[model samples]
Target: MANTNLKHSSPQGGRLRSAVAITAILSLYSASAMADGGMASMCFFITYMKQIVGSVAVIAIFVWVMGYFEKKAVLADIGQYVVLGCMIAAMAGWFVSQAGLVPPSCSA
Candidate 1:
């Protein structure tokens, strides 16, 4: 009789665990790389992120309007994208604050 207790090795068995471990290692490496700059991430979040969000909002509105006139998009379908853009623009400040990236004071 053949042994039924033998474990069969599969090609996909460890893929998920390997991926998670690799991701964790990469995350740690990136975090360490960013650690050298101290406030670098904060500065980037404060200065560049706001501008990016605002630009996205402007672009979203422009595209939505253009599509509306061209008859390529329905009003109902486009509302979500426009609303999301506006919401992101509106919340840019809050998002920055949440990221804890207050710029250094000039008094120093």
Candidate 2:
């Protein structure tokens, strides 16, 4: 009697699984995208960015303090850029939040 205990191997090198996973993810995203006009996702992104801005600002301040003790002008310069980035990110987040205040003219 011939042994038939071999495991089945896919010929497509996992592509089939990857394709199915991508399709499922896209379907879920589309369903979510249709809900709330995407406000939930936008708010989530805004909140995340706000947190990141705060964290980056603190790190930049720490960098500035370290530069002060090290007396390295380069570190101070880098810190300046890092702080500038945090400020810009914060401003962007504020702008997005404020935009939510006024309803669109086309909305009924």
Report the error of model 1 at residue 84, Å. 2.3
Where is model 2 poorest over a 10-residue stretch in terms of lDDT? Answer: 99-108
lDDT of 2 by residue, 7-105 (tens): 655547468878999789756765675585665555444455566679989999889879878998888888889999989877775675578652333
lDDT of 1 by residue, 1-108 (tens): 644453664547568769989789756755765785756654543455556667777777777777777877675357557768668666766775567555663111
Candidate 2 lDDT at 100 equals 69
lDDT of each: 0.63, 0.70
Clashing pairs in 1: none
lDDT of 2: 0.70
Among the numbered candidates, top lDDT falls to 2
What lDDT score goes with residue 59 in model 1?
A: 75
lDDT of 2 at 17: 70
